[model samples]
Target: MLINIMGFLVSYVFCLIITPLISKLALKLNAVDIPDHRKVHVKPMPRLGGLGVYLAFIIGLIVIGFPIMSNIQVILGATLIVILGILDDIYILKPYQKLIIQFVAALVVVYGHVSVDFLYLPFIGTVDLSVSIIPITVLWIIGITNSINLIDGLDGLASGISFIIVFVFVILAIINQQDTILMLSFVLLGSILGFLYHNFFPARIFLGDSGSLFLGFMVSVISLMGLYKTVTVSSLFLPVIILGLPLMDTFLAIFRRLKKHQSVMAPDKEHLHHQLIKFGLSHRKAVLLMYMLSATFGIVAIIFSKAILWGTLLFSLLVIFISHYFYNYNFNKIIHFLNRKYNKT
Candidate 1:
């Protein structure tokens, strides 16, 4: 416990100290984000800020004496992701190019024996994936990697939501008594918090593709390690709830694009944060709202862990209610009308 605390503190301090240097390095390398129509920022900002997070997290693990062999595959995979992200930040790789690199990284993680092997269904018990685990694991990793990248629209948004998600995992790891995961979670949490200080609204730096991709990769891997390995049916939904906001946003984006006969991979300004801004919220307010929503999902995930089947049902209802409220569809209005009528009677 003390060691984990030390790891967290060391990671926090390291990231805080290194972020400014990384920002300057990004400027020197010309790895900066120049705003345009689809972006929210008005000026060019240095990227590659993920360098601080990556270095700080690695150093934190070293201080904790994190077992290398046990997590060697994940480390190797994350390294590939960071490298790909750095290159993408500098060169602005084509979508296909990024996809190929993401697949390779996923393969590294899967082959490292970190792939999902089975799932516990509600009635069918544990269903082994057999040969399917390979593809499924790769898809999961790539999907989540892109999900985080897709939601990196607002300053401090992706990193802030990720902080909440990682913190939830840290609690879950403690509950499950998974020491390695706890240490990793704390280190990651610290790393993001440190980076968030600079990455917030009126930002000094951005995570670019490097930081977003690296974070997405690590989050996916940690979810697998800490949540997916559990043998309960409710455990299957835990990661989904914990990461609900980004994953939902990603899926909605794809659906919206597809409905308009547009390519799903094409970027647009219609993301959730964009919609919030269009609805009159400031950038900072929008980002904070996202944090609250992400934290809400995190709470549901924790409840799911403890409440099992009932918790899953409760989470489902909450999702429905929240979706209706946000969309301002007729369901909520109808409910209100019906309640008023019942009161009058």
Candidate 2:
């Protein structure tokens, strides 16, 4: 417990100290985000904030003497992802190019025995995924990687969501006796919390692709380590519940793009955050509302871990319905929708 606290504090303080330097370095490298039609910020901001988080995580691990050699594959894959993000932030890599690099990084993580090996369905017993595990794992990694990246539209939004996830995982880890996930999650939590200091509204810096992708990759890989026990279908939904915000946003984005015959990777301003802002919420309010939603998902995930199957399902449905309602309808209308639903029921 003390060791975990130390790791979190070290990572947090170091990230606080190092992020400003990273910001200056971002400026020097010409890796800044320029405002355009789809973006909310009006001026160019440093976009390499992920470097601070990455460096702090490594520092935390080293200071704690965590065995890096044992997780060499995860480190290598994360390094590759950070490099890809840096290149994209500076040079604006084509979508296909970014996809190829992400695929390679996903493969690296999956190779480290982090892949899902099987699934225990409702009626069928444990079903071995066999050859399908690799692709499934890779897809999960890439999907989550981009999900965090895509949700990085607002200041501190991605960082906050990631923190909620790691915090939930930390509790789950304690419950499940997953020491690795607990330690890694604590370090991640600290780094992201530190980053949020400069990342919130009226931002000092943006997470850029580098930070968001690294966060997404870490979340996916770490969840795979502990959340896929598959004791029950509800247990299987733990990761999904914790990561509901980003995954839901990503799913909606993909669906909207497909419906419009647009490329799935194309940039757009119709994201949940954008929608909330369009519905008259202030920047901070919109972000805070999303934070509440994400935290609710985390709470449900914790309940799921407790094997409260029916209770978890009920809350999950409510959360999904509310989230979908907010995504498609005005914020003010949510009260009316809930009232009508209650009256109908």
Q: Which candidate should be chosen as best, given TM-score against the real structure?
A: 1
Model 1: per-residue lDDT, tens digit, 107-149?
9888888878878777668888888988989999999999999
RMSD in Å for candidate 1, one decimal?
A: 5.0
On the 0 to 100 scale, the lDDT of residue 38 in model 2 is 97
TM match of model 2 to true structure: 0.92
Q: Judge candidate 1 against the unseen true structure and give its global Cα lDDT, from 0 to 1.
A: 0.88
How many residue pairs clash in each candidate at the backbone level?
Answer: 0, 0
User: After superposing candidate 2, which stretches have Cα over 4 Å from the reference?
Assistant: 308-332, 335-345
Q: Residue by residue across 1-345, what tens digits does model 2's lDDT show? A: 788899999999999999999999999999999999999999999999999999999999888877789999999999999999999999999999989999999888888898888775545657788879999999999999999999999989999999999999999899888888888988888899989999999899999999999999999999888887546666567788899989999999999999999999998999999988876666887798889989988987887777555665676688679768766876557644544564578
